[model samples]
Target chain A: MAEFFTNPLVQSVLVPVAGGFILTGAIRFANGRAKGPLVAGAAVALGFLVGYVLIVGLPPLPPVSNQQKLAYVVAGGLIIGFLMDFSRRPPFYRELVYIVGAAAALYWMALPKIAGGTAWTYLSLVALWIAAGLIGYRLEKSRANVVNACAPLLVAALGLGLVALFGRTGSYSQLAFSLATAFGGFMLWNWPIARYPFGATLLLGGAGALVTIAYALALYTEASPYALAMLLLCFFAEPVARRIKLPAGKIGEAFRPVAVGAVALIPALAAVAVAYLTAPGQEAGY
Target chain B: MRTRSIIAGAAALMASTALIGTASAADNYKIDATHTNIIFIVDHLGFSNMIGQFQSFEGNFSFDGKSVEGASVKLTIKTASVDTDHEARDKHLSSPDFFNVQEFPEMSFTSTKFEATGDKTAKMTGDLTMLGVTKPVTLDVTFNKADKFPMDPNVFIAGFSAKGTVNRQDFGMKYAAGAIGDNIGLWIEAEGHKQ
Candidate 1:
């Protein structure tokens, strides 16, 4: 049992699942059944908590700068809080607040790193990512609840890919993995058959976390830009899936997630290929 | 007139003694980047030691022959210049897993105290800052030589050899903890020119 706990993979998967269940139980007790926006909000918040705990426990904590900490707290808090509130209100101002808050947080963190043209490039990328998330939220809203629920699972998959492509030893990669598993546990209650509320908020928050992790990797590590671009491209999968006409029946219902998965895979695979080829040294069978 | 001449001669003798005292004071030397080398070794899977070096580093020291305790040294190494002679491995080492060069680009050391153990050996205690973590480390340093340059008679040079060990985990480099050994051995041979 001790040896199992020592393993990185085991630690990463186990903690999040346990945390998710605990949060689920707490929310159910508090709300007398854990249905609606409250459950979704609790899951997202608790999911990140699990990841943060794992990072803290990992032998030596990486020295995060004050600016980085501020960015993470402000951006993560605003996005989660805004989504949760928007689930109840559906107010335009809620999203506006999120956009502005997240942008300011990223700018603060990026100020030390950016100079001249790089500053503009960083700003543009942040703007584009916010735009992508908002557009994704709109697309998920119009679609069935299952589409929104599945988005977290997709983010989890991306996190796993980051671990495999880069190294699992990194705190960022482990945090990403933990976040994914947490969402995975929550996704069970949010199946297509069950009409769990605030599916949109859960999906958008999951996507927001994924985007933040990817950007952080790019900024702080040798993480390839191509990989980041591919992750961003996955946001368009929802809108594109909506355009495709399918046979109306059980077949279309089964095909929806598969289509979205396939669309996401194209860029993901390309990104992996680019990473392998462009990695410092070119070796066969990479 | 004889008494005045005697006082004048004594004043002249005092001035010459002061000049000699100032001339023999501590000499300050600037580290010669081209000649100085910083190398490190770590156990690789318990099979063999993996050796690497930093290509870019600079430092300066003030050395006094009479009072070795008064000497001080400061060094700064560019973390990005870490090279293990393998490109892929070097890249991985420089990434977030090891040094995290992007976030913390340089490692620095500044001496707090120096204790002379022998005529040519001393213990240097300093704070070494790496990956944004500062820790006190003591290096066993040997004064190799100090002499006028053979090529340029006017220039003076001083050289030292130092060895120390530090746990990588101490500086937040916990990646591949078991696979790669935690204790990293450091060997530095530096030559400095008087400035």
Candidate 2:
């Protein structure tokens, strides 16, 4: 239990829940408009719970081979989805939720062999992000909201440029890849890209990418079973901040979603450098 | 008595001729660097296999009726020639993890004993010194063929191949546990000619 206190996964999971309550409570205390935050919280919790049931519970309804082991993964996915959904109200909050969730997933997934583990994952991620950013840009262009469309594309391009040049390291690389991939997938189905966006698409894809990259890269050396679910911190940060009524709009909102994503990238890029330096020479076989 | 003496003298001359033929038939052959290879393989993150070969080596051998009467080999592998396609990992292998070329410049293997096991097979024992660790290793060897070169009769050619396994840790080389297996499998193919 004490270990859980220090674990990233536990913190990530609880932050959103606590934030939801605080958001609703704060809104009630400040503006007496608790309804929006409360509804958002309930939607997040419901989305998370339902998503968990569908993703984790449904797959092994009859109890397949590794149902018990998959319990945490399923639960994590649910929480992430809930958080992403919960942040939907302020628009930028929703984007922040997705970005944080995606970033967290990426960082956790890329491990010991960061370059070998996340290079390809990063490539695929960058490609997806570019596509999504493009779609978002095109949509905004159609509506003459060129700024919004250009925003995602510009951010994505900058992120891609950074990744291509320096490459990601340590825990951060995994998260970066996850965030990029998730954002891309989300754009493919969401507002500007899709007429109807499934609530769990970005949440699940982002979380799943995190798992796959970590599993593929074997980056779980520092990872706990719950580390995967910890993106809820970023996911819920915006909603929680909104409930507190932090002043600012548009640019502030846009920046909020990417804040945690950027933090997550630092450690990831560092890890990549460390792993590359430590491993040094190439193996006989490629 | 005179006839018997003549016959005995003729038999003595015949015996001497046979001895000379056997002596000149088996010539000592030196490794021809133009044709020799030392290769290795290892698993890369349980995902793919990486393969590469060393560029240079030297070998020496001589045989008599499938028996290795005398044989010795010395090989110097150029540390810089290591390649595994991926630029990053390749650089690492040449670093402190495995080769550590800076501290221990060259890896060498010298054979001290050769024991014939069958008509074309033998177990060659040698000391493989790498990263300052010297360990006795036995290699499974096949004595392929030895004969006068078609182009140059003065230089006789002899070919052989040997295989062995050495623990990387045994040589003070350590790295990824699951990524690169400990027991590094190595194979060498060589041909030698009278120098």
Candidate 3:
């Protein structure tokens, strides 16, 4: 079992994807295959947690470091997200819950910077991530297809993973890729048609993971800020994708996820390009 | 008036001697970066041991001969200064995998206990704090010598060497565990001058 993980492919890709798919499949089945707003969120968060432990190892329990803090944040967000999914409260109640959650996660991860008098950096990151979360919420509330809604964020995760990889932090890159693959596993259940209900869970986990990881890379690594910001904006490509013409009914619906993902991929790829351009130092050959 | 002048002169001389005595008895020494080398050795793929050194650090210690009791030592190594002779690898070492220099920019050690094992050897136990985690680590320390500088006879100096082993996994640096050995071997060739 230990030697199995020693393989780079198993450590990096297959483990996360396979782990995510199995967990999500189990969750989907346990929920009586319902289409309630309680779809894929728990699966993705828990699956990513499993993959993190398998590949990167479990972080310290007290979670003193930001890396450990991140693990706790995602786990905490999973529970909070379930509340958001089940509640039919006033919009203010939900919005306030998300805001506070986002702030707490940001504070825990960026505490060193915040304590060091870099409040502006933390504020800018929180503001950008909140905006991203707001976009995810809007998608959750919309009558659009589930795949179309999740694809943009999934693509954004993919982009940030690449940015982290080329920008000198392989560990953070693995984290982002683990998240992207987790989303991929969830999206497989919704593609071509809406097989599950979409709601706050996706909104929280999808947006929350991107926001937290982006803050980490920006604050903790030499990853390019230009790329991180550009990838954050890729979520906004949904508006452009909505404007693009497609077929009249189910035919067009089948193609919508592809269209939305492709459009978002443009900026994501551009972000990766910027990361490559700004990456420090050429690789030293052995 | 003559008696008063003699007493005053004697008091002034006594005060000077007391001050000189305090200065000579001071045990604290400031580490000389120019003469100190803080380095580590780790196995790379079982083929060979890879060597790396921290280029920037500051430390101080208080030692009085080989008594080896209640002596204290403190050091702070800049994580960004980790150099393995390769520029790109050094950058990677500073990333989340190894130091995560941006989040935890400094690794520090503070001595908690010291016990004499031999005339010239002692065991120093300290808390090695890295990646925001503190672990009790023991180093086999040797007191090489402590005397006047050869270049400057009037100046006092001390030299020592310490060796230890720590598991990177214990500190949450479990990135390439099997491929890159977990037990990191540390060696410190430290020299200090009287403060």
What is the C-alpha local distance difference test score of each model? Answer: 0.66, 0.46, 0.79
Residue-level lDDT tens digits of model 3 in A134-251: 6656565542667777787788888988998887887778888888888788777777777665555665665677678887888788789889878866666667777889998988
lDDT of 2 by residue, A1-286 (tens): 6444333232223432343234334433443343332222222233223322322223333321122123344345556654554454444554454445444444333322244546675664444343333332233232222122222322332233223222212222323332343233223222232222234422243333333333322222222212222221222232233344323855564444344335434434443344433442223332
Candidate 1 backbone overlaps, count: 0
Per-residue CA lDDT of model 1 for A1-286, tens digit only, reads: 6445446676567776666556655665665543433444456546655555444333332225421352255235536554554455553544554456456555644544765547667676666456545544553553455544355346534533463345312556666676677666665555434334543344345445554565556566666666555555555566677667878876776566657666666666666666555555445221
Best by lDDT: 3
Tell me the spans in candidate 1 whose CA falls farther than 4 Å from its real position: A1-3, A34-37, A55-63, A66-94, A115-149, A152-160, A163-171, A199-205, A243-255, A282-286, B1-24
* Most DockQ-accurate candidate: 3
Docking class of 2: incorrect
In angstroms, the error of model 1 at B188 is: 1.3
- Across B10-70, the per-residue lDDT of candidate 2 in tens digits comes to 9999999987876766566677877877888776667866776666555566555345746
Choose 2 or 3, whichever is better by lDDT.
Answer: 3
Runs with alpha carbons beyond 4 Å of true place in candidate 3: A6-8, A33-37, A87-93, A118-123, A126-134, A141-143, A283-286, B1-26
lDDT of 1 by residue, B1-195 (tens): 999999999999999998777666888999998889999999998999999999988899989655568789999999999999887677778776678787788999999999999989999999999978899999999998899999999999999999999998787776666768999999999999998
In model 2, the runs with Cα more than 4 Å from the true position are: A1-286, B1-26, B62-66, B85-87
Top candidate on TM-score is: 3
TM-score (C-alpha) between model 1 and the true structure? 0.81
